[model samples]
Target: MTEPTSNKPFTEQTVLITGASRGIGAAIARRFASVGMNVVIHYLQSHEAANETAREAMRYGARVLTVTADLRSVDQIERMQDKLAQHGLIPDILVNNAGISHYGLLSELSENEWDEIIGINLKGTYLMTRQFMSAMIERKYGRIINVSSVWGISGASCEVAYSTAKGGINAFTKALAKELAPSGVTVNAVAPGVVDTAMMNGFDASEKAALENDIPAGRFAQPDEIASLVYFLALPESGYITGQIISPNGGWLT
Candidate 1:
């Protein structure tokens, strides 16, 4: 972790959060906006949801922008960059929170399924980070926070593809952190376990209860809890905390 002096006030910084239409991404957006930071909410196709998130952030008196870009496409991402530049909303903090999860055994996974998961989860992160990091490097100060999964750290039973993608993210974070540390930019990942989001809609009442019972905390983590950790990591004072895969798993994993 390297400490870089910044003359800009924290309120002037802008954070771009991908997949910010809802869930943990939305919570993270609100958390930053609450402190009057400029927020750019990126969503794939959820226009209304993204607008709703923008509206909520605006309540905090922060300048909010909603962008629609398919992270899987470089052309779209470049266009997104152009749009952000046009709006004077280039990000000082980049949150690669856009990702998809896959379930079931690897044997049942189709080629397309694997590609979609990897393309969005892994490749998208690479493209987004690559596109935005140069600016951060030139500025000599930035935060790159990636959203990962506990399954990436400790592999899950059935989610092989999803787990692999997130594991790649974990590795990416470590390597990029070291690469950017010299430039005074920090890169880290937040791998949460069993967050209470729509991603768990596939589980039934019994399944949910069974999973919860296995954890010492006896419940799933809320998006706001994860958002708070992200907010802390993005703080200017948190410059010494880079290359960490901080997992808030309710004591489920040590």
Candidate 2:
């Protein structure tokens, strides 16, 4: 295993995490903030939740800014970029953790539902990456970490749409990593299994217990655990570790 690089100081870096109002995204933001890096917490409509996350991050003595934008909109994202530029916060690290999970039978899924899932999970990632990658290429330094799911690697039965979207993310991560590696930008994905976040609220007590029993670890992962892996990936020493789909799934799929 390669050690993390420290050539770049934490205080000099900035991170932008989407869907960071709560759950895994919020944890990732806090992880970066804990190191005193500038943090940009992006949310679609969770203004108050985002603010709460911002407050927590700021307590770590890192500059925190909350911004909102519909990832599916080019104009909004551009405007968001403009706002970040105004604040002098061009992200050195981009965490594409903003996504939604859909759980339902494929046959019963509506067209609109499918579109929404793909649009937010896959398309949104593409757009955000396209928007910020140029600067990283120019500077020859950047980290792009996509928050994928274990289901993306091992398909889930009832979550066909969600699985498909995340599968696309895995492919996107690999291909983009190869393309950006030459430019000194590393692209990777963190696919966690059964994280204990609001996303799992749909399951009841019995369901949660059954799922845990299925995993060898016998428990769901914490958001901070996933965040730690993301943080490690963003390190300068991890430059050689690109084009990988790192699933921290507690022996669930492997």
Best by TM-score: 1
Q: Return the clash pairs for model 2, or none.
A: 5-237
When summed lDDT is taken over every stretch of 10 residues in candidate 1, the lowest stretch is 1-10
- For model 1, the stretches where C-alpha displacement exceeds 4 angstroms are none
Error of 1 at 218 (Å): 1.1
lDDT per residue for candidate 1 within 1-254, as digits (tens), equals 43694557888999999999999999999999999999999999899999999999999999999999889899999999999999998789999999998779999999999999999999999999999999989999999999999999999988999999999999999999999999989999999999999999999999999999998999999999999999999999999999999999999998
Error of 2 at 59 (Å): 0.4
lDDT of 2 at 87: 100
> What pairs collide in candidate 1?
none
Global lDDT of each candidate: 0.95, 0.93
